[model samples]
Target: MTAAALLLWRDFVRDPARRLWTEDSGCGEWGCCGSPLEARAFLEGVLRGMSRRRSRELRAVVDALDDAY
Candidate 1:
């Protein structure tokens, strides 16, 4: 990954609830919880969709998650 991507991954992998709050002040779903690896994968999928110019798809993927906030 590029330095930026790696950095973003690091930020995303840190405390998933905090990450959600950092993003949007949260809609309050982080307590639903998931494994760290799961959170990372979800974040990566969202990032990939965004990088590919697929924001709607990205939102769909993110929003579909119970832990997304």
Candidate 2:
């Protein structure tokens, strides 16, 4: 996956999966299971798809929640 994400995929990020601590194969529907990064990526992608500005605002709110917690 690391090799494929880097040298092959050439999508989203420029670096490989090894370089991304948040990168996930996101293979869950198949019952293979996945990591938190995959879930995070999915949510983030959804947010960003709506609007990058809105996503940034949402992220700031999440950060504030963490800080308050």
Best by lDDT: 1
Per-residue lDDT of 25 in model 1: 44
User: Can you write out model 1's per-residue Cα lDDT over 1-69, one digit (the tens) per residue?
Assistant: 333333333445444555444433434344332233445565666566565565666545444442443
- Tens-digit lDDT track for model 2 on 1-69? 322222222332333453453444554442243344444455455556766665676566444533432
Show where candidate 1 strays beyond 4 Å: 1-31, 52-69
Q: Count the backbone clashes (under 3 Å) in each candidate.
A: 0, 0
lDDT of each: 0.46, 0.42
Worst 10 residues of 2 by lDDT: 3-12
Query: Candidate 2 versus the native: TM-score?
Result: 0.31
Candidate RMSDs in order: 11.2, 11.9
| TM-score of candidate 1 on Cα atoms, chains taken together | 0.29
